[model samples]
Target: MEHPILFISLILEKLGLPIPHGLIGETFLEKMCQPYMTYTWFVMIFLVVVGKLTLSNIEMIPGKGQNFWEMLIGGMYDFFEENMGRELAEKLFPMIATFGLYIAVANLIGLIPGFMSPTASINTTVALTIIVWVTHHIIGIRAHGLGYIKHFLGPIPVLIPLMLFIEIISNIARLASLSIRLFGNIMAKETLLTILFILAGAYFAPLPIMVLGVLVSLVQAMVFVLLTVVYFGQANEHAH
Candidate 1:
């Protein structure tokens, strides 16, 4: 599949620092040439720099950067606490916060002229969904020990086989659901902006769409995190 060329890649080529094409060959891990992967690296480094700056100068009187981060992170923590209660929230906040921050940033980065949303890629979304699936199972196991398997079994012993089959399929469906939803939304937003730019010219075409895109980015991130929390909450529950 041919990927769209990005402004960043063009600049890199012009400066004699072109990103390697398919640096890993044609294996499943071959994303080096993808514009989305290039921007994924960009978003990671961008987040790290912003995080460092935000935490570097902790003032007795909070500065703008400190205050902004405090509000964002603190608000998210409070949200988790409310949904999952204090104990589970504390246990899961770091993972939840990482997902929220990364998705939110990745979704918005595409709005910039030289960038693309990593979440706009199916591979990125699938990888994220797999992480959530694995982490939630680990949480369930830690909470329940070897009894985690009971989650797939019904209360009635006679129904265990049937319930297990159904539950297993249901869990697999979640992986598809999470990945496709994020990828579809972000990809659609990017496609729409491209069409509008072509139809009406860049300067005047995309202003309204960009505004809506910002809202979509934040809302989608929130929805993904909230669903993840719900899955974690379910896993932590003692199976009936």
Candidate 2:
């Protein structure tokens, strides 16, 4: 599977850079979406809506848009602040909330005809996992400097190599686990819905599943955010 958001290559191609068509030389466009655009189009739309909602509010007394933004972002702020401390939460809110809200929107977008959630693609989930992994580590290094790597060496000096290897494996596992969990749930849900509509030949058969899918989507997004918080906390342990 070629990663869908290879924007650098796409831009280069647009500029007449002459991208070769194979393996490392070429990038594949996202194939899942139809008619005109892929899930990327929906992602762009979601970002635009979120941007308008968040940026259009500039008053103390809230209007409808401000109220909506406050309820959404404020609740997330409180949740992370309580769990991860005010300073860290404030620093992390933009990235954390963006991922959480984006995933939720992506999942929900599938309910629309002719649209699919970007989260349904493993490429998308893997990209998100990479972002979370890299961001937390960057925070860790910034917070602890040279001492940040000690955590991977284990509590005892004698077992440093073994522990370091284990830690490396564990971190890699986190990337895979995060990506697969999101991808499996989303792909499974969509697949089941398709199966129901085709096999059972009844629209009613998928209604209950669709309702359940909404709940699953919300939970998955929260779980992704919560896991990021856990990583963030782990990385910044020295700060406290």
State every prediction's TM-score relative to the real structure: 0.87, 0.79
Taken over the whole model, the C-alpha lDDT of each candidate is 0.85, 0.76
Ten consecutive residues with minimal summed lDDT in candidate 2?
27-36
Best by TM-score: 1
Q: Model 1: per-residue lDDT, tens digit, 56-105?
A: 97988998999999999899999888877789999889888998999999
Residue-level lDDT tens digits of model 2 in 1-240:
233334444655677665544323333432222212345565767688877866675898887777887798889899999778889998888889988988888887765544566787777899999999998899889989999998788888898889999999998898899999998998787767666666664547878888999998898999999999988988888632
Considering every candidate listed, which one attains the maximal lDDT?
A: 1
RMSD of 2: 6.2
| Model 2 quality (TM-score) | 0.79
